[model samples]
Target: MTGRAHRDSEADRIWQMLVGLVWETRGEWRRKVSEATALPFSRVRILWRLVDEPKTLTQLAVSTSDAPATTVAVNDLEDRGLVERHPHPDNRRAKLVSLTPAGRRLIESARRTVRDDAPPAVQQLSKTDLAHLRRILERISSSER
Candidate 1:
C-alpha cells in the first residue's frame, strides 16, 4: 500500500475502535440504570430526560434516537401512570409530557445507579478533560443537525 493510503486506513480503524469503546461504555452504564429502575433502557432514557420538567413529544423525539417509537413508549408510560400528558399551554394541538412522582423517584434511583456505576475511564477524567469532551460532543451533535 502507498504510505499515505495506509496511514489513512490506520486512522480510520483507530477512530472506529474509539467509537466502539464509547458505545460499549454507554451501553454498560445504561444497563445498570435499567436494572435499577426495572425499566427498559429506552424508558429509562425517557424518564431521565423528564426528570427536570415537562417537555413536548417533539422534544423527546429529538432527544432520543428512536423517534419513531417515542409515541408508543409515551403511551405505555402514560398507561403505567409513570408519566402524564397535558395539553401544551401555547400549542393547543401539542402535548407536554412529564414524569409523575413515582417516575421521578424511579429515575432518581436509576440516576444514582448510573452514577455509581460510571465507567472508570469516564469517572476518572479530570474536570478540564470532561469539559473538553462535552464541548467536542456538542460540536459533533450540532454539526449532525
Candidate 2:
C-alpha cells in the first residue's frame, strides 16, 4: 500500500499477480519436467486428458485446444510406444486415443512432484478459500457460449 493512486483496483492487481504467478509456476513445472522426464509437455497433456476416458483424435485436439500439430504430437507419442491409437469403437474411420502402460507410467512419475513436494503448500491455504477459488476458476474457464 502506497500513496500512489493506481488506476487499477485491488482485484485487478490480484488478477494480474495470479497470471504472473501462473507463468512462474508453469515455468518451474516445465523445467522440472524437462530435467526429470522424457515426455514433452504436449504429449503429457494428451496423456493426462485421456486419464479420465478415451477420446478420438478430433476430440482430443478440440478439448485440448491443440491445433493441427495434435496429429504430430500424438503420432510422436505413438511412435515412441507411449500411446496407442486404434480405430474408434463406434466409428471405424475415427481413432480413439488412450494411454499405453508406458504413457501411464510417465504421468505417474510426473505426479510424484505434486504429491511429495506440494502437500504443504496446499495445506497453507484454507479449505474454503481453495474450494471457492477452484469454483471461480472453473466457472471462468467454461466456454463463453
Candidate 3:
C-alpha cells in the first residue's frame, strides 16, 4: 500500500470533523457578530433558500432537510420581522416566505460574519493546500446531493 492511507479509511473521521466544524464555525460567527444565541443556523439555511426566491413553509422544510419544526421557526422569524410571508398567487392555501429588507441586510451581515471567524491556523495553509482542501471537500459532498 506504500504506507498511503486510503480515502475511505478517513470517512468516519471526516464525517465527525465536518459536523464539528459546522458547529464551531457557526458558534464563533454568532459570538463575533450577534448577541442572539438562538440564531439556530437553521434560520440562515432557510434564508439562503429564500435568497433567490420565496417558498412556503412546507417547501422550506423539504429544502431544509424536512426539518421537524420549520413552521414554528418561520413563524418566529416572521414575528421578529426577519422574514415576510406573502400570499401565494397560485395557491391560496400556501404562503411564500421571503427575506425582509431587514432580512436581506442580516444575511449580508452573515456573509461577512463567517469570514470573521475563520481560524488563524487556516491562514497558515499553503494556497495550494487550501484550494485542494476545499476542492476535495466539495467533491466528496456533491455525492450527497
Q: Count clashing residue pairs in model 3.
A: 0
lDDT (Cα, tens digit) per residue for candidate 3, span 1-145? 3334666567768888878877766666656444342477777677778888888888999877655689878888888888999899999998889999888888887776556645766778899999999999799789888
lDDT by residue for model 1 (1-145), tens: 9999999999799889878877877876777777887779898778878888899989999998666799988988888889999999999999999999988878777656567554688889999999998998799789998
How close is each model in CA RMSD to the real structure? 4.2, 5.5, 4.3
How many clashes (backbone atoms < 3 Å, residues ≥3 apart in a chain or on different chains) does model 1 have? 0
Clashing pairs in 1: none
**Ranking of models by TM-score:** 1, 2, 3
Residue ranges of candidate 2 with Cα displaced over 4 Å: 1-17, 113-128, 131-145
Specify the poorest-scoring 10-residue window by lDDT in model 3. Answer: 29-38
Angstrom error at residue 64, model 3: 4.7
Clashes of each: 0, 0, 0
Off by over 4 Å in 3: 1-9, 36-45, 62-68, 89-92, 110-117
Angstrom error at residue 132, model 3 = 1.6
Candidate 2, 22-117: lDDT as tens digits: 665576676676555676676777888988787888888897766678889888989988889878878889988888998888878887753324
Best by TM-score: 1
145 in model 1: Cα distance from truth in Å? 10
